[model samples]
Each structure stands twice: as C-alpha cells, then as structure tokens.
Target chain A: MKSTQRNMRRDILDGLHVGIPIAMAYFAVAFSLGIIAAKAGLTAPMGFVSSFFTRASAGEYGTYTLIAAHAAYAELVVMCLVINLRYMLMSAALSQKIAPGTSRWHRLLMAVCITDEVFGVSYAHPGYTPPAYTYSAALISSLFWALGCALGIVAGNILPQQMVTALSMALYGMFLGIIIPPARKDRNVLYALAASFVLSGLCAAAPVVSGLSSGTRIVVLTVLISAVAAWLKPVNTEADGEA
Target chain B: MEKHSVIIYILIAILTTNLIRVVPMALIKGPIRNRFVRSFLYYVPYVTLAVMTFPDMILVTPTPLPGVLAFAAGIIAAWLRLGLFAVAAICCAIVYLLSMLFAG
Candidate 1:
C-alpha cells in the first residue's frame, strides 16, 4: 500500500511538471477565446462556465457563433458534435493506451479532460499511462483555461474598441497555427486546406448555399471536404501517426 | 442572448463535447480498422479549421485591408511553425498596427 501511494504521488508530480507548460499555453489561447465570447455577448461568468465544461476552443467558437446567430438548439448540437469530432478519434487512441482492466471511472475521468495538448503529452508517456498522471495534468490546465477565459471577458469589457478588434483575429491566428504545420508537412493536407478555403469562400458568396446559416455551412463543408479528401487520399493507418 | 438561453447553450456544448470524448474512451477497446473512416477523421481538423479561418477572419475585422494583411502575416507566422500564442500575437499586433495606419 505504501508503494502504491508513492507511485501515485510520483505520477501526479510528473503530470504537474509536464502540465505547467500546457497550462500556460491554454491560458493564452483561452484568453483569446474569452475575448471572442465577449464579442458574442457572453458574460464573464458565461465564458468561465463554457470553458470549464467544454475545454475545446474550436467547439466553443462554433457554439458562440451559433449563439450569436440565435441558431436553433439542434443546430448547436450538430455544430458542437461536428466541430469536436476529432476528439472522438483522440479519445479512441487514448483508450488503447490505458492498461486493460483499469477502472471504467478512471477512463471516464481522463476522457473528460483530453484536449489536444493534454492528449499529446499523455500519449507520449512510455508505457501504460497512470490515471493519476492525467488527472493532475488535467486539473492544472483546466483551471487555467477557465480562469483565462473569465479574465479575458473582463478585459474585453474594458479594452478599447480597436484593441478588441485586433484581438478578435487571435482565434483565427491560432486556427492557422493548427492547420498550417500539418499542411507544411503533407502535400495532401495543403491541398485539402486550399480546397476548403476556396470552397468556403465560394459558398459564402454563392446565391443559395450562402443562405444557409453559418453553423450549418461549417458542418456541411467540414463533412463534404473531409469525406472527399479521405476518399481521394485514404491514409495508411500503419504509417500515419495522425490517425 | 437571454441568460437562460446562454445557460442552455453552455450545457449543450458541455454535454455534446463530453459525449464525444467519453463514449469512445469508455467503450471502444480496439483500433478502428476501416481505412476510409480513419482517413476522414485524420483530415477533419484541417478541413474544419481551414474553413473556419478564411472568409470569416477577413470579415471579422472593421475593415477588409487590415484583416487581409494580418491574415497574410498570420499565415507566414504559422507556416514557420511558430507556437500558437506567438502566431496569434503576431496577428493581433499586425491588425492593430495596420488598423491604426488606415485610421490615420
């Protein structure tokens, strides 16, 4: 029993060591997200609750857009699901990393905080990951994420209009940061990204498709573009770490 | 948005996102074997984020010029593989600078 306690404590400390950097990064990004939430008319408390529970930038961004549009609840559901579908893949990958016969509750708890950065660090662990490690990492990062968001909203309310306008682009910058690295490595990703940009631009301008709500357009385009890319350039799961 | 509606939306966001994360980790034990499904999932983030970034990014700013220029700067910064915070900071700085230039 003493050894088990020692091991768990070590895991928790290790988690914190890795988690601090992730926590800092999340605070910066979540700050931008909070600013966007403020633009969408969300109160600081609202931003805090949203980030605390969701912990997903892209998903929350879509949700804010839907909220601003006064979109239907069904639209919100589908948009959240679609924007966050990548988490499903990440979670599946993580499921295999947990030792067999680990408690189901631990798996659920770990899953609750599996953002991209957290998953990256957790999956890099040498052997089967201890639940305590992930729990500690998640706890530190999630608190920062929520706090940064609430503080961002408060700051947004005080900052000048021009500054807020500038900050609004931060989310897009982060999105570019995400997609561009992969595009730089893979030709297929670059092509898919370029195609998405062109098609999305066209859809916004075209007569009928332009009429679709922004949330609906994003969902439709994501499915359509990704499906075609998959059909045309099916990834070799054995070779590709991304899958 | 009303206070109640915002609360409901936040709940929906939480539930839907957690469902995607928890269900697979809790239930699925094996790697998905289907090649097409794997490929599709692999491409989803790039496509979805790319779609979201363009057009909307340009439209979000007060004027088109600063938005366009800042976007180009952002793409360059990101293409160089700057950290997300750095890229975002660069974009925000560029927008602020250019907007001031245009305003003056």
Candidate 2:
C-alpha cells in the first residue's frame, strides 16, 4: 500500500503538469469575476466562495450582478439553475471514469470534485481512475482555481477602477487558451465551436426566439450543438484510456 | 425579511445548483455506448467555452471596432502559444492604446 501511495502521488504529479496550464488559463476569467464582485459591492470573500463551490466563472458573475441589481429571487433562481445545468452533462460524462461498482460514499466524494476541468480530463481518459490520483488531481486543481479567485478578488478590491476595466479581454483570452490547443488538433472540434457560435447568434438575433430567457437560450444552444456534434462524429467512450 | 435571511436564500440556491449538477452522475453509472454521444461529449468544452465567451467579450467603447481589434489580438497571441499573462497583457495594451487614440 505504501508503494501504491507513491504511484498515486506520481499520477497526481502527472495530472498537475497538465492541469497547471488549465488553471493559468482560468486565471483571467477568475480575475474578471473578482472585478465583477467588486462592482456588485460583494466582499472579496463572497466572490471567492463562488469559485470555491461552483468553480464556474459565468454563473458566479451572473449571480453577483443579479444580486447587485436587486433582481427577482425567482429570476435569480432560474438563472443559476440554467447556467449551471450543463454540469449535468459533464458529470454524466465523468461517470464512465469512476469505479461503477463502488458504493455511494465514493460516488459522493467524486461528485464534489467533478468540475468542467476534471470532467474534461477524466472523460478524455476512460477506464479505472485510481481513486487516489483522480481525487488528488481534483483537490489540487480546485485549490489552484479557488486560490486564483481569492487572489484576484483581493487585487480587484485595491486596483484603480480604470486599470480593472482594461482587463475585459482577459477572460476571453483565457477561454481561448482553454479551447484553441484542442481545436487546433481536430477539425471536428473547430466545426463544433463555429457551429455553436453561429447557431447561438442566430437564436439571439431571431425575433421570436429572442423573447426566451437568456438561461433558456443557453441551455438550448448547448443541447443543439452537442446533439449535432454527436450525430456528426460518434465516439465509443466506454473503456478507460481510449483517447 | 432580514439581510441574513437573504444570504441564506442565496446559499441554498447555490447548493441546489451543485446538487442538480452532481446527482445524476451518481445514479447513472453505465458505459456510454452511443458513438455520437461520446464524440460530442469530447468536443463539448470547446463549444461551451466559445458560447460563454461571446457575450462576455469586454468593450472599452461604444464602437465595437476597438474591442474587435483587441479580440483579434488576443486570438493571435494565444495562437502563438504565449503564456496566459502575456496574452492578457497584449490584449489590454491594444485596447488601452486604441481607447486613447479614439477617445482622445
């Protein structure tokens, strides 16, 4: 078991090497989130807690601004629900990685750590995820994410307002980083991104569909894009380490 | 009616979101065999990020010209595989300079 522990640590380190870039990519958006929190009159810690729990920048920023605007509780409830609803797909995809035969206690812990980052990496590698490696990677990535937000919040609090405003592109740049590397290697991925963009834009531009709630629009777009991509290119991802 | 009660409501809302995200996977633990489903699952993050980034693009001016320019600059910087900090710095510099030129 001692040797097994060493092997697990090594696996985590391997994951860390890959995950560091993911966290660095996340910093720009996470920092932007801090700026949003400040504008919303939320304390820095309040902003940090959003990342700590959800690790989702868009939803966290939406919640912060909605609260700031004194938006309706019912609307905020729906926005939160719809924005995060994609995680359901992420978690479902990650289910293939964990030990299917395990007990509820194990599933409970894995569920807590299943962010988009973890889910993306875990799904890309199908098969038996050594519990130790998967959990440790999640713990480490979550820390990097949470710590980045905490630092960004503190920075946003003290920075000059103009200086903060200049950072609007940082989040886009970060997302670009998260996506471009993968898309560069695969035309299918590129097509999915392009299709999703045009489709979503059309949805927004259309008069009738434009009346739908923003959250509903987003969910619809996600489902549409995923469905099309799945139909275009099928992948059998039942086994572990297939990618 | 109190402020504390409002905070509690927010927390519960957030918790509900987390639960909705986590519960289905806990129960659904079979091999995903649909070829199309697997292919799309693999590509979803790219689409998701692209979708999320569209509305969030920051604009420093009424005209989208400068923001568009900055967006192009960021993509170029990222394509060159610049570090995250460098990509951000370049985008902001372009935006700051453009804002000065246009507004001044």
Candidate 3:
C-alpha cells in the first residue's frame, strides 16, 4: 500500500512537471480567447465559465463566433461538435494506451482532461499511463486556462479601443501559428490550406452560399474539404505510426 | 446575445466537447481500422482552422490595410516557428502600430 501511494505521488509530480509548460502556453492562448469573448460582449465571469468547462480553444472560439453572430442554438451545437471532432480521435488514441482492466471510472475521469497537449504527454508515456498523472496535469492546466481568460476579459475592458482592435488579431495569429508549421512540413497540408482559404472566401462571397450562417458554412466547408483531402491523400497510418 | 443565451451556448460547447472526449475513451479500446476515417480525422484540424482564420482575419481590424499587414506578419512569424504567443503578440503589435500610423 505504501509503495502504491508513493508511485502515485511520483506520477502526479511528473505530470505536474510536464503540465506546467502546457499550462503556461494555454494561459497565453486563452488570454487572446478572452479578449475575443469580450469583443463579443461576454462578461469576464462568462469567459471564465466558458473556458473552465470547455477547455478547448477552437471550440471556445466557435462558441464566441456563434454568439456574436446571434446564430441559432442548433447551429452552435453542430459547430461545437464539428470543431471538436479531433478530440474524439485523440481520446481514442489515448484509450488504447490505457492499460486493459483499468477502472471504467478512471477512464472516464481521464477522458475529461484529454486536450491535445495533455494527450500528447500522456500518449508519450512509456507503457500504460497512470490516472493520477492525467488528473494532476488537467488540474493545473485547467485552472490557468480559466484564470487567464477571466483576466483577459478584465484587461480588454480596461484597455483602450485601439489596443482591443490590435488584440483582436491575436486569434488569427494563433490560428496561423497552428496551421502554418504543419503546412511548412507537409505539401498536402499546404495544398489543403490553400484550398480551404479560397473555398472559404468563395463561400463567404457566393450569392446563395453566402446566405448560410457562418457556423453552418464552417461546418460544411470542414466536412467537404476534409473528406476530399482524405480521399485524395489518404494518410498512411503505418508509416505515420498514428495507430 | 442575452445572458441566458450565452449560458446556453457555453453549456452546449462544454457538453459537445466533453462528450467527444469521453465517449471515445470510455467505450473504444481498439484502434480504428478504416483508412479513410483515419485520414479524414488527420486533416480536419488544418482545414477547419484555416477556413476560420482567413477572410475573418482581414475583417477583424478597423481597416483593411492594417489587417492585411498583420496577416502577413503573422504568417511569417508562424512560418519561422515562433511560439503561438509570440506570433500573436507580433501580429497585435503590427496592427497597433499601423492603426496609429494611419489614424487621423
């Protein structure tokens, strides 16, 4: 029993050590998200609540966008589901790494914490990952994310208009940061990005399609572009070691 | 949006995202074998984020010139593999300085 407790403590500490950098990165990104939320007229408390519960930047950004657009509730639901679908893949991958016969409750608890970075760290762990490790990492990261978002809304309210206008660019900058690095390495990603940009622009301008709500338009484009790219490129799971 | 509506939207986001994470981890222990499904999931993030960023990026700023300049700056900074915070800060600074330069 003593050894088991000691092992759990060490795993938690190790998780914390990995989680701090991820937490710091999340805070910075979540700060920008908060500013966007403020621009959409969300209170700081609203931003805090959203970030605390949602804990995904792209998903939260979609929520703020739909709110700003006054999109229908159904549209918001579909957009959130589409934007966050990647997590399903990540969770599946992580599930495979968890040792067989681990408690179902533990699997469910770990699932709640499975962000991209959290999954990356957990998946990289040798052999089966301990639930305590994921729990500690999730705790630290989620707190910082929520705090940064609330503080960002506070700053947005206090800052000058010019500054807020500038800060609005941060979300796009972060999005670029996400897609650009992968584009640099992969030709297929670059082509897909270019196609997505042009298609998005056209969709926004095209007479009938342009009439669709922004949330619906994004979901449609995401499904269309991803499906075509998948059919054309068909990533080799064996080569990529994704499975 | 109303306060109640905002809460509803946030709840929707929370539920959808958590469900996506939880349902798979709890229920699916085996790797998905379908090649097309795996490939589609791999490309989803890039496509979704790219579609969201463009056009919207240009429209976010007070003026088109500042937005265009900041977009270029962001692309370059990110291409150089700067961290997400750094890229965002650089874009914001560019927009701020340009807005001041063009202000009456």
Which candidate should be chosen as best, given TM-score against the real structure? 2
Which predicted model would earn the best lDDT? 1
- Model 2 TM-score is 0.79
Fnat: each model in turn: 0.79, 0.48, 0.82
lDDT of each: 0.80, 0.66, 0.80
lDDT for model 2: 0.66
Per-residue lDDT of model 3, residues A54-137, tens digit only? 898778887898788888888888887876776776676677667778888999889889876677567657778999998888
Off by over 4 Å in 3: A1-46, A56-111, A114-141, A152-155, A239-243, B1-13
Candidate 3 at residue B34, lDDT? 78
Kindly indicate the candidate among 1 and 2 with the higher lDDT: 1
The residue pairs found clashing in candidate 2 are A126-A240, A126-A241, A127-A240, A234-B35, A234-B36, A235-B35
Across all candidates, the chain A TM-score values are 0.70, 0.78, 0.69
TM-score computed on alpha carbons, candidate 3: 0.73
Query: A168-206 in candidate 1: lDDT tens per residue?
Result: 777678677667877888999999999999999999889
> Which ten residues in a row are the worst by lDDT in model 3 chain A?
A234-243
For residues B1-104, what per-residue lDDT tens digits would candidate 2 score against the true structure? 42433364358556867786679776786767666666666666667767765544533435677667766777677677775556766766777677666666
* Docking model 1 quality class: medium
**lDDT for A22 (candidate 3):** 62
* RMSD each, Å: 4.7, 3.9, 4.9
Give fnat (model 3): 0.82
